[model samples]
Target: MNRPTYNLLWRLAMPLVLARLWWRGLRESGYRKHWNERRGHYGARGAGWHTLWIHAVSVGETRAAEPLVDALMALYPNSRILMTHMTPTGRAAGHELFARHGDRFVQSYLPYDTVSKLTRFMRHFTPRICILMETEVWPNLIAVCKTRGITVALVNARLSERSLRRAGRFGRLMTQAAAQLSLVAAQTERDASRISSLGAPRVVITGNIKFDVAVPAAALARGRFLRQRINADADGDSGGAGRPVLLCASTREGEEALILDAFKAMPERPPGMLLLLVPRHPQRFDEVANLAGLRGLRVARRSTLGQDGADLDSAVEVLVGDTMGEMVAYYAACDCAFIGGSLLPLGGQNLIEACAVGKPVLIGAHTFNFAVASDEAVAAGAAVRVVDAAAMLAQARQLLLDTMTRNSMGAAAFGFAAAHRGATTRTVELLQGLIY
Candidate 1:
């Protein structure tokens, strides 16, 4: 727990640390206005109330917190919910929390997990409890929160082999931080064991909160509007058969290259085969467009597809979903999905979006982060996992070539997503014990 050693150790981890800093730099530049507005909440502002500060780091975490946040408001009607996120994408998505739940909650960019920023943020919120979503654990954040007599819990907690091994190297440092957690409500039993090994408090199996999300009725109607906007036929075909669209969601950088290669080599690229590539981050929309263009395929822009959601484009391949908050529409419109980030070392993208709609989902072997949910889907025949791009291409080709197979896989996936539902209730029960 020595500061000097920890700083030196983190310095050795410069590559990852710098990568994060570089990412924040891009956010600052690309989303200046958005960042400025949200960044204002970094200091102590909502003090002197019963506050439960929740950290949903990015889009996935933010989306996953919908049900839990709802429960928090239910248990403590007067208690203010302050949600913090570090990324612009996260901040934007977190705003949805406010939109859906009302003034009981507010979203802000989390202060840096350093002591000064941590102190400032803590003093501002003066939270009675801190519930960290998923696997995020910042040392100074935990230490400061613990010192403030805040009851801290890690909700929907997961621990992969990679994270476990990495945290293992910093045994005392991680243990001291993790030990501060008052309760550890994990997503999987495996996650509990991993955290326990790292000296986390006895972790309770609370299940995954992503399953608890309330898929908006507005989103469903909007998805149809988006499909019509893109001119996707009622039958789920792109105007003139190119190859049935593979609407990819949440794809990151390096994975695009692999996906492109697989798409390029398809022996009989289906009629109306459009790859609507939506990068995970808005800042990387341009970056991903460049990568997809380098593949020498005709590309389309979603913004240009239709003027209004009610209009129709009906003819555009490779529509880049570079806009903010339109995932539900694209996921509904696509015939199936290739959920990226899994093909490379990025640890997979969300399959729930596709699964919700019963679209056949394909992910690669790099799904360490969501291994619990991913495995459940695969076991139930709701999702398919390939070892690499080669296998991924083969699976995609097979699924695209055969409608029955695709339909069956999608059916299984819908079943899987449905059965694994209700984490929000369990999570709410846990928080009610404290916040209520």
Candidate 2:
């Protein structure tokens, strides 16, 4: 215990401390209460089990693992599963997926990585094999699992160049922690070699699981219903976009400025260009609305836009579809989409959503979160990666002018997504191997 303390003591203490400082920030947030409730109650009934534990952080990772989780459930019918997450969005998404398993799939908030909390979590789940998505390595989490002799694997693992450089500056504790994983199923060869440089062993290239995103029939049906409600064709199915519906979705804090700039700069802004700007976080919705107002664009809440059909096409009412759980409908109606969270310092967003719906996808080169997806999409001609606001405007304008390129890109995008549909199978295979 005296040898460097594995750094978990500090890691576990920081969150509780930050939670105290930002108690006000999370005070009005329903998610805070929801996560705490799940941590305290849901999935706590069965404390001990031989479970296949999978941990994902939030909405993105949870969705990325959806296909794999379904595959695992079908492939290993007898295996009980434990799914864990830190954030409320992740907990909600996990619950939606895992709840149907009843006694089989249990979802919970991951306990803090304190010795005691980790001990409790381990005792409760008793997972023989731990599957972690992306970069979810805590020193205590890994060291304790190693101490307990539970096999652990990293799936769809990626170590960003920026993250690696930051780890180097921080004395590489993160890298050291990651090395304790038994196997690393990396998203790319570059990621594999880089993590190996950071001391991870036996890294294998498995491709990204997000590529295996399955279009739910229910989601498609729901999208159709919503599209009909909006006076857009419910069954158009991305063939011959009846109109120019531009969905500026999943924008992070800094990305909106670039989007707004491009929108305002468009000479004779293409007719029927209905912009739906959805920020990445719920808290920022009003902030982004205010920013849009400052840009001299009339803003309309999508809810309000539906209620009142005034200014459906005008300098007023850029529809704000600011609600969660409706992204599928939003994506389906969007003729083309600008996947945000990338234009500035935020890296990038899930361009996969647009691509999944066969909406011609646009992105800024700043995406580090889904690097392989972005790269593969661009390589497959399913996406256009731009450098800045100016470049984004240029690319978007070009697409607007050239319907043929947009249609071809949309087809290629769908092809790229459909072609990489085997991660769920690969993941299922490994998971079955674990349980059996």
In terms of TM-score, which candidate is strongest?
1
Give me the displacement of residue 141 in model 2, in angstroms. 0.4
Tell me model 1's lDDT, rounded to 2 decimals. Answer: 0.76
Clashes of each: 14, 3
- lDDT for model 2, on a 0 to 1 scale? 0.73
Cα-based lDDT for every prediction: 0.76, 0.73
Candidate 2: which stretches are off by over 4 Å? 1-28, 34-45, 170-172, 233-243, 304-317
lDDT score of residue 235 within candidate 1: 56
Look at candidate 2 and tell me the lDDT of residue 341: 77
TM-score of each: 0.89, 0.88
Q: State the lDDT of candidate 1 residue by residue for 271-302, as single tens digits.
A: 65667788887877877777768877666677
